[model samples]
Target chain A: MSTPLISIRDLHVSFHTQDGVVKAVDGVSFDVMPGETLGIVGESGSGKSVTANAIMRLNFGTQVDVSGEIIMNGKNLLEVDDDELRTLRGRQMAMVFQDPLTALNPFYTVGNQIAEAYLIHHPKATKSEVREIVLNAMVKVGIPEPTKRMDSYPHEFSGGMRQRIVIAIALVNNPQLLIADEPTTALDVTVQAQILELIGTLQEEYGSAVMLITHDLGVIAETADRVMVMYAGHAVELANVDELFETPTHPYTVGLLGSVHSLDDSSRGALQTISGTPPSLINLPTGCAFHPRCRFELGENSLCRTEAPQLHAVGKSRSACHLPESQLLQIGAKGGV
Target chain B: MIYFVIRRLLFAVVLLFVVSFFTYVLFTALPTNPAALTCGKNCTPEVIARNEVRLGYDQPIHVQYGRFLKGIFAGRTYGPEGASVHCPAPALGYSFEYHECVTDLITRTFPVTLSVAIGAFVLWMGIGVGLGTLAALRRGRWQDRFATTFSVVGISLPTFFFALLAILVIVIWGGLLDFPQYTGFTENPIKWFSGLLLPWATLAILSASTYVRLTRNGILEVMNEEFVRLGLAKGVKRRTLIIKYVMRAAMVPIVTIAGLDFAALLGGAVITESVFNLPGMGKLSIRAVTDSDLPVLVATTLVAAVLIVVANAVVDILYGFLDPRVREKV
Candidate 1:
């Protein structure tokens, strides 16, 4: 296949503390294609934002020890210079944060902020041209009176409006990749839907790859083209969205499906919670990080505790679980229900 | 903007009037006679009453207050010593002790006082804010540790000690500096600055410690705000983001408290000026208080009161600018 938009190889991200070194992202690997909306689903503290920030080189000032190849566009992102990295961000890859309330500067007028962001990448655009684009983006994101509201500060805008402004800023440069870190988690459900719809429309218009990070399976189900399930700093499953949702091969994926299954579908019984909180990345288990939680274990599935599993194709999806072919079919069937 | 400014100015005028009236009431309500303090301790009760009649102290309190306020606003001609002394517009009063109008003394001396205050304000704020930003950026590093330690020592050491240390270092021990006392800047600018340098340095040492602590805390808090991380993700050049976004946002409360502190510093500069032997307003204020000179006392108090009001107004205007949450009534 042609090169994916992003390919991580043997990525190790660690932090040195007085207590010890914490391996936050341990030997993680994945690939995403251009124009694909890949959902990275994980609970809080699962190193989701860290992975995205690392790709954007936002981790420079932070004290993180990282080694591995983050290949994008045939270039090793790990080796990119500071100035080059800046040019890449917001122009090639923009990020939207979770808290819409604080996403914009309080002192600046919302219109000026959007205009300023647009100017950063496209410096030749005149004032009216920039304002035109800002208003269009704001209106497209469903904001009202774009002209009047543009002169207002961040506080004057509601939580939803502010999120829309943030969306406007992220799409101001028409970046090739958008990294949204739980962008809808802080807003009300109705507002979240509006923002999600905005993202969907903008993504189609711009045709940019989106790495949407959230533990909300509902969001991924509604928006992502493909989904990657992460556990303990590792991607446990990667597959096309429909294939993974209809038939998850990994036990962890099965557990996640059971927990997030909607009751409106009647086929799903009482929701099954995944039994425990996500394992801490600071001290992950020896073998498969999900081994202790997996119930479909057989002997030298003792090997499952001692040896880590790679992403091997079981059916239409790849899973990092050491289950037999028969058991994979059973897991997938159970997940489909 | 002008309407808001005018409103604030009106408030200031009312506030000054109330304060000057309160000063009059306080002196009248005193247990002893003002004429006794004005005349000699040897003067008997009859002589004191004679002096009181001559000085307008024998009049009703409101009339006495009217005369005082009139002296400050327009002018006054008081014949307390059997001769009329015409004090012109903006005159505070005739200082029987200084043998000149109190407003004239304050006017002649305000520049020196202002220079020392402004210099100290700039020194502490510049050094304090710079060190604070450095410390916050290098949070756990030696730079942070050093700043913390230095601030602790700076806050603990009294201004008198710092003034003496500088005097000892430059004047006595180092023998490299000699700042002659009481040369007004208008008379000789260079000598005036030299005379006041040690006092300004002394004033800055303590004031800067608090400012450093305040700014460090402010920057650290602003850094924690998710908006800062959002700016970073927006690819705002780190330097530009720090200056334009982070620092500007962090300056809100710091500016408010700093303005109030600057006003208070003029009041608190007594020790600093005394140690350096500078004859500025602080020293003048100390003498006025000791001698119970009503004219000088009331004049200095009024000046300090006006400074406070002006400073507060500036801070409030800045308040509307820094935090856009503060909506101006257009």
Candidate 2:
């Protein structure tokens, strides 16, 4: 529909390390629609952050080997030169890192830093105009006394406020695509709610697509429009947010949803956790990365080991397990921890 | 700030007094006799005893120290033991061996030491920091490799080795620049500069090498900081980011070490100064040692301690300014 705002195809990213090649993002494919909030769900080392960095092109010369088309506005982002990537990072796409405390220059006033973002794209802006725009951005993110706070250094702001300042810098440019990697993980729960709400409002007002990467399913449940579930660098499930929760197909997604504490059942049992650590990408399982942890333990787990399963649909949901069509509840009963 | 300065001054005074006492004890404990030095080398034993008695060397040690401390503030007149030892206002003590007022000697030497120190500090930092930034900008490239290799070579070589190598390259072998000889800055700044050119290069080579390693490491660390990456993610150009953000952020740690090195150099590098024969602080110290000029030696040590403390305080303030983390605590 109108050529997805951003499209990625068969993205493969491997990091060359001292001990062999580690496949970080293996055969990931996804798209984001204009003005939509697309939540990428995965635990640490699932390659979600790498995929986001691939879009911005700031992840350079890091022993990273990347392939596949990142078609955005009709050009593969992977092929853009460094200069164009520099321009693209702030003018078109921007990112917000997870650690709010360490995400702003300690020497600069918050106002100067935000204004720097705006001026980078429009370098000739008058000082007064830049000030106005920067303060407005702070205001939009709900910072009090925005004008005064602008001149204060990063340490002067509380953690929540610093996160807001980062958001201000990211949104000050009105970028076309925003990649926020766990932007609220550092804040208190209340502040996290406020920040998530602010980002949603900003996206709506600016009409820019958002690629929000986080492991917290609750965050996705509250904020995401459509969701992509990644496990071991592969998109195991993709569906509308409601469909994902209501009729999940991926075993990893099922484990994730069950792991999240729900309202009525919150008191009935201890919070569930997915069994086993996510596999090391350096020496991943022979076939379906999830097979070792999967159930329906077919004889020798043959299909899973010999042939990797491509994502297949079952009704309104998709899963990447080798099980043929079966009752979703039974499959989960077999796969669930 | 005023309170901090007052406390600092009080600390300096007490510290100087302690340092002076130690220097006095060490000087008195030496085998050489101050009484004989004050009288004459060939003076008879009877004459030396009379001179020692007259000079207050026979007085209790504490009383002698009290007199010496008082002399530093107001003034003093003492015989090199019943002879004539008249010193002016702001007198520290009289050196029997040097046959000169200790205060005058120190005051003259202080200016010479400071001139060399300030001049070389400016030059060394400029070259070191400039090279460091360029290397960081081209990280992983050949220039970065060159800087890395150079830093290894520069750091591995002893300070004395560099000083000698510089002398050979710039003075003796090259002959493009003359061997350094000290010229007072007040007399002729041009001559002072040229005369110290070889010394400057020598100091620069010794000092610049350390700065290059520190600065490269500092800048590289700053570049990897999360904020820097976030700064780029926010659309700031790389050049602006490097200039305004990374270097400024890196300078706090670098400046602290630089201030420490500055104070250390002020005391002197004996080998470097000796090789150059510049008659700077180190050479003065060596001369004082050989002559057993107790007052001058004590005064020099106290002067060095004061400079180091002041520099440390300045660095703390500068670090607070450059690093918000420091300012917030204060």
Candidate 3:
């Protein structure tokens, strides 16, 4: 994979609030190779966004505690100072947030904003150079009439267009790694497809490693080269996208795919749903975080209830579960994986 | 934008007319014999009758009101027939108590009040917004708590009491500053500043507390907004992010209150003026009211109404400038 562009190792992030310490992202590890798209699929509060933000050291507040390595281009982002991080952040890596409505500052025009992003890092760049760079970025992101549209404010653009501008801002510097955290969640269905296509095209053009975080398994199927399924702040499954979908070893991953495919083919009967809600991060269950909701034969054993399980290699993928492969195969056949 | 400003200005004019008319009607209904008061307590019936005619009190209320409006546009006359006095355009008639032109009295005193208001406004805004920004940045810490506590005390304090305390401590006990006095800025800039320094501080300290709380709350709210987070994510400098994104957004609400407060202060911080013996608009208006000088009172009230309306219009315009969405809607 040519020395992965970003290698996140055992990342942990917890926010201390009055209620308790929220273990948002715990022991999550992954690598984004050059030009590879890594899809992080998880429901809300699964720490997908937190893990991505930690790469740029962006998730900061009074009581936040983030530890472990976020190695990008040989530097550990977690250990770097703020000044270094700032310079690295738009020049080497940039982020596109989930909601386009708020991702761009409303006060400035589109062109001005894009220019500022480029100018901050390239402070010595001339006005003409900045204008050219900004206009080219706007064009690359598919905004029409780069000259005129650049003057328009965010409110003038539709939801999809705003998202395009946000993408433009992120790609203005042509960063090697792009973190798009649910970039299309707030978009309409048709617009969502277009934005995804736009992102795919831009990623190809820039040859940047894209970390696409979303809860939609369908999106991961269409976009990700490798998939990581997270449940309650932990990566429960990781494999090639095809392998993960063809045979999901984790019980939680099976249930997630089941809930979707079951709805798709209703002839199979009513939609199947995982029974219990995700456990609270503050006071998680004693065993595997998903044990309470997992539907597997060996899940009834005292070991599944009292002992925590780590990700273990099984065939082509890793799964965090106590169920043996023989038992998972049978369950997968029954569950229509 | 031009059309919007013109529309607002027209609306203000109509509003001012309505306000002045109502105030005139209410003032006329007070039942006091203004003519007899001007004629003196020992005056005979002939003197009272002459005073009534000279003052135009014998005319019907509607005629008097029409003349008052007309007098504002053109010139007008007053006094007995043998010694009729002329008032120039935009005349507000004569003050019986001060025996001076109402327009002249207001014009002369307005500059003093304007200077005080402006000096205090600059001081309070700098102190208030600065403290607020600091507090918001250090939210949940001792600095924030101290600012919050200070604002509460400031908001609860009476203007008169604060003025007195400033005089007693800064002037009498400490002798660190001189008592406040009015000096024309045009005549001597340094003296003007030094003379108003104590009053400026007193006013700034009191009003700054309110602004500190306001700015702190506004900034805190804005810092949480997604746009601000986006700015941070963009790797913009922290100072640029706060000033351009967070502080600019916070200024919307603060500007609204500040505009109105500034206009109100210009109309006259009466207690502050009186305590400082500045002869500013506030003290002038108070004297007019106590002396039953109807012309001065009505003129002062109208001026105050105009200031408030102008301030409100300015705030609306600023709002449009600050938010493009608002600009589009307007």
- Lowest-lDDT window of 10 residues in candidate 3 chain A? A328-337
Across A1-337, the per-residue lDDT of candidate 1 in tens digits comes to 6568888888878887777777777777888888889999977767787788788777654568989999987889899887777777788888888998987888888898888788877889998899899998888778898888889998888898899999898988898899999999999999999899989999999988999999998899999999888878787888888988889888888888887757568766688877666666667877888776777765564868888888888888888888886789687987773
Residues B1-330 of candidate 1: C-alpha lDDT, one tens digit per residue: 667667777887787778778866775676656667655558788877887898788899899888887776678875456665888988777776777877788877777677788889999998788888889878889999988887999999988888888888888888766853657767888887777677777888888888879888999999878777777777788798888788988888888999988997665368877777666788788888887777777778777877787778777776766677874543
Question: Which regions of candidate 2 deviate over 4 angstroms?
Answer: A266-273, A297-301, A327-337, B1-33, B80-83, B165-177, B185-191
Q: Which residue runs does candidate 1 get wrong by more than 4 Å?
A: A265-270, A292-301, B1-3, B21-32, B53-67, B77-86, B89-94, B138-142, B328-330
Chain B TM-score (model 1 vs. true structure): 0.92
For candidate 3, the TM-score of chain A alone relative to the native chain A:
0.96
lDDT of 3 at A294: 74
lDDT: the better of candidates 2 and 3: 3
Model 2 chain A poorest ten-residue lDDT run: A328-337
- Interface RMSD for model 3 amounts to 1.1
Q: Report the C-alpha displacement of residue B263, candidate 1, in angstroms.
A: 2.4
DockQ of each two-chain model: 0.64, 0.75, 0.73
> What is candidate 3's local distance difference test score?
0.86
